[model samples]
Target: MAPQIVGLAFGHFALRMNPILLLGALTGAQTVTAAMAAIQERSGSPVAVLGYTPAYPIANILLTTWGTIVVAVIAS
Candidate 1:
């Protein structure tokens, strides 16, 4: 829901309200996928899942690194 709202807002402001682009913007990869699987027993349609593949690993790495840094700083 947060991602959908964010996507809609972004689409409205930057993508000229195009439905295709707006739909594309809603793909949030792993987090969304896992949530859907838990709630609905499915990870959404394959195309929707695929749409965010490019961002998945990059976001994962960045978040993991940030989390590690934060923990290390707090522990020290």
Candidate 2:
């Protein structure tokens, strides 16, 4: 996944910058969510999951929207 994300970054460098940042953030969110789930499973507590659960979706949406705005601005 990391490698693929890196490939995407390089692939899009000529196109624009916002997409690379957006993809990187989305990948990071997935990685953290997975790690938190693993920790929660081992710890047998919801605390680990709670730490990131609420912020994940919100960040995803906000970052995606921000990326779109950036692209639009850059294009114009």
In model 1, the Cα lDDT at residue 45 comes to: 46
Model 1 ranges off by over 4 Å: 1-4, 16-30, 34-46
- Candidate 2 achieves a global lDDT of 0.59
Candidate 1 clash figure, as a count: 0
Q: Count the backbone clashes (under 3 Å) in each candidate.
A: 0, 0
Worst 10 residues of 1 by lDDT: 35-44
Which tens-of-lDDT digit does each residue in 1-76 have in candidate 1? 6867776787778767644333433444334555433333343344443444565566678779999999999999
**True lDDT of residue 44, candidate 1:** 39
- Judged by TM-score, which candidate is best? 1
